[model samples]
Target: MAEKLFGTDGIRGTVNKGAIRPDMFLRFGEALGYTLRKAGDRPVVVIGRDTRASGLILQSAIVSGLLNAGADVALVDVLPTPALGWLTVQNGAAAGLMITASHNPFHDNGVKVFGPAGYKLSGAQQDEIEAIIQDPGFDCTVPAERFGRVVDAEFDVSSYADFAVRTAGPDVSLSGLKVVIDAANGAGVSAAEPVFRSLGAEVIMLADVPDGVNINTKCGALHPEGLSEVVRANSANVGIAFDGDADRILVVDENGEVADGDQIMGAIAIDAKAQGRLAGDTVVATIMSNLGLEGALSREGIKLERTKVGDRYVVERLREGGFSIGGEQSGHVVLADHVTTGDAIIAAIAVLSIMVREGKKASEVLSVFEPVPQLLENVRYQSDDPLSAETVKARIESVSENLGDSGRVVVRKSGTEPLIRVMVEAYEREYAERAVNEIIAEILKADGQ
Candidate 1:
């Protein structure tokens, strides 16, 4: 049978809409509970959510379904997705659920499932759950008194903060630097401030207050203009912005310039290499990573391996190749030795620690690699037709040949949207812009309007 609900991340949509409605989420919980019970006995499932207004309602529906299927539920309120993943494995639970739309707008919501290993559910496991959800013969009912009880658990954000501080090693501390943290009014607001304060940095916070409807609304990594202003206003050493789920982070230098994932990864990689901690002298990144990053690492005799776009794919490559570091350009960094998933707070701490130890400015410390000129344009389509039209394909090929060794082009259809993303990277800004525009024009033509 073909899968219908799950995406590359999990089940997601505009809340109260197709497949993400309350009834569907309830059914999903039941299917997940049943699958876990069949694998073991009276399995425990830990659940967490971001600050989206729909989170509580969805949490209630999911908990009801899990309890009816005889699975004990631990409701961890208002925690980051990675924290839930950590708690799931730490408590030896059978699975975990996080109610979040991640970087999506507040109007959207999602349910992400993590297996016993604390990683996202694999394709086979997700398929099994979908099968159970679809089967007419599968029973989702449970008798009264047999229904599992829900327990409200206090999640200690301080524990994660302590862990992040410790990971910077004994020799590092941000004792005197002034820093600003923008929490995107999402999950990190609770922990990020304390963590920086504990490390002795002067902390200024913005967008940390979540009104349930404000999470990721013109703030956080997707919209960092406010963060830039905050940094400039305070003359802070640096600024950090976390997404709605707090699994990713982007940096802004004291000069109010945005520093993306490539810059962050390059900074960390150089430090690791110097400390002899970068395993096999290699770092794993997605294909979307700027070519400048690869060139920078090459200068230091370090290798860059490209994986697919997902952080999971990057992590899988890291493990398979025995590399210690990997991340995406979107700022989802994974230090396998530290945490199971991306922890934005932890990542920022690591970067700041480097600054402290080196006795350098945040801009100086983070500017380990220079980025090439890159441009990304998304072309929306009227229909969900395939983007491999002869005209579009020919244009891409021609652009690639024209750029030759001086640059590269990547044209891909977005996984979650009916759009084609045309990206180009070149040594010259004008060339990159022209190359991307050519491909975009062709894609627009292929859309038949």
Candidate 2:
């Protein structure tokens, strides 16, 4: 069997390791270039990267491969993932690639491919590229005369910032809002501060200094505890934290309470429904979304559709249903009306707009629903197929039967990492904790951990 390269997001792993190495990235770029060349002659492929030191090396190698395979390259230098996607569509490129591991540590890196419309690649497209990369006999060389040229397109980042500010509409302004933005020391540092300040916001930057290795060390959406504290210390109206690539966000309220994607989506859905802007009166989220979100939307006469655990799946379902809003609990909110992928800055703008419109504190508007007690535990595994173990399966089944309809258990392997995510939600915190602990014990035992 062939090795799988694409994950729920994209091709990601530790930098200089496995398929993330420069040599493999060069071939990966060749595969992508070949695929694009088949669609158009000397197709343009827009490329950008986050603030990791490895980004430059990987970018050089990939650009060499793309040029070698007869694809013109528009290098955007350092830009957020969403900005790169937006630029790809604006530049009429055949495809786009953003090099960053998102919320992962700086030593990690990735390549997220976007189609012409700035959406993620479909399964069929991924397969085509993977086949070319895995085939040892595949030829990637092209005639020197047919080689493509490279162009400096770094100035286009401002265009993306303008588009992001426009997502909140012309009437929206952040004049009185004091925003604490945690840029994860990544690509967002370049755009987030400028966009917010342009709208008259008093922007306080946090974790904004990127020293290559400090991208997500103790900051960003994944580690927003510090963001919450800073918000309180500064008495800011709201705090927003972006991951390494600035694709997703987690907000902190005025009182320093962290708001995850579910809360953010709920607030957006409620506001959209009130404004009659919510298409189909629906919000699409992942199965990992809390039942509280469903109940809250239900009360508002809105339908909540659940997909698998990826933001891509959420976007797919939203498009299928023509829903205007969707995202994951992990801070990947895709506002289809504004973006094709999870654009953290745009989503933050939406939330801020809501606060401005309602004339309320971030604490008042962000907590749209009271989340039910939920516990998610990630268990690492070195063995293969721990879910297949009899003890683990039995424990899962037994827990399900015992919890019945009042609670639920969701256990699945992480697509991007070697671990199992076990989530349990119930009406009571103790019950949820106990159920999660039991499942973890069984999983660890099964994996011989």
Candidate 3:
């Protein structure tokens, strides 16, 4: 097992390799169960997973570990990540474990742990779990008489759909809208249709069949081109595409234009501000959010608080500042009023509700601002500190100085993967592209590539 298990989201990697192996998942579950059992007698832990073939192996291993450790388990099969967290809180479970790799391909998988309040576990909490897993003398199994039970809780998923529908409020309805949803053949396959159809929208589904190996294959929020084409072909009012775990989304407008998280966050902020529902008149976003979002929100007397690149960081800032909304450029939006984590469905419902209330087309409502030209590239590396190289530092400094005020330069290592992400935003696309290439060249040179 790898010494570390958690990443920016959770422990994720290719199936049966590294920390993603079934044995590692079992150890993680045993550790978590041990902790939960220590906290409460016969503590219940809710579990869910996306539709991946490997999920069967990982789930069974973890459930066995949890049961052996005397932790009761409730399995809500094939549910979205956000729903797992919500259910954890609703059931007062000691914790919730969601097996998914979010937007990653089906070959990869992960396990995300949610605390009692439905928030991701804290770093300290993760450390404790790791310690338990790594301890050689620690026993994970309980006496036979102390073993806990496992139950299938599939029916509880409908309650989550009901809760998501209520996020749009009691009076809102999508009476005349034709909505197309691309579920990415992931966890949202079974959840998206019912929610939208209940709201009176004419619903069409794509990528909704989960054959266990097709999730995020040229579909979902990561690839919106196919969705855009379908939206235009069907004359749909809007198109929504969700990632593997359905915790994030990307939207397609009537003009076949795709709107990313920055645009969506800006529109939601403006709407919430107007409705007096925006707490602190602030929207939290990662540094990866487009500069145009900042400028647009500023025009509306709203503040955009920037955090490090992670929805967890954004949510932390939101909770600390009592803000109502926050998210990433990747469509992982957190509407604090409804969810403890990023929930694509709730965020989509919010956008749809705005359209219904304003009686505006998706293009008109979604295209809230013109984004500044931005270029992003990711470079994988094996070095321990590629950015520490003098040449790379110099190039970063030079680019930032050149793009001061009018543009921005962000270069950082990804927390979830061994890659450096380089993003350059400027008034002109060509300039942003050139600047990003220059930095990547320096990075490559520093890595001896």
Q: Which residue pairs clash in candidate 2?
A: none
- lDDT (tens digit, per residue) of candidate 2 on 23-126: 88889888888888888887999999999999998898899989999999999888889899889899988899998888888888888999999999988888
Q: How many steric overlaps are in each model, in order?
A: 0, 0, 0
Candidate 2 local lDDT, residue 28: 88
TM-score of 1: 0.95
Expressed as tens digits, the lDDT of each residue in 243-358 for candidate 1 is 99999999999899998888888898889999999999999998899988998999988999998777778877887888888898989988877877777888898889888878
Which candidate do you rate higher for TM-score, 1 or 2? 2
Candidate 1 wrong stretches, greater than 4 Å: 1-3, 140-145, 152-155
Candidates 1 and 2 compared by lDDT, better number: 2
Q: Considering every candidate listed, which one attains the maximal TM-score?
A: 2
The C-alpha lDDT values of all candidates are 0.85, 0.91, 0.90
Across 1-449, the per-residue lDDT of candidate 3 in tens digits comes to 54577778878888877667888778888888888887798989898999999998999999989998999999888888889989998988889999998888889988899998999987788889888887857997799999989965544678899999988899999989999999999999868999999999999899999899999999999888999999999999999999999999899998889999998998899999998999999999999999889989999999999998888889889999999999999999999988999998999999999999999998889888898898889999977788999889999999899888989999999877788999999998888999999999999888888
Lowest summed lDDT over 10 consecutive residues: which window, candidate 3?
150-159
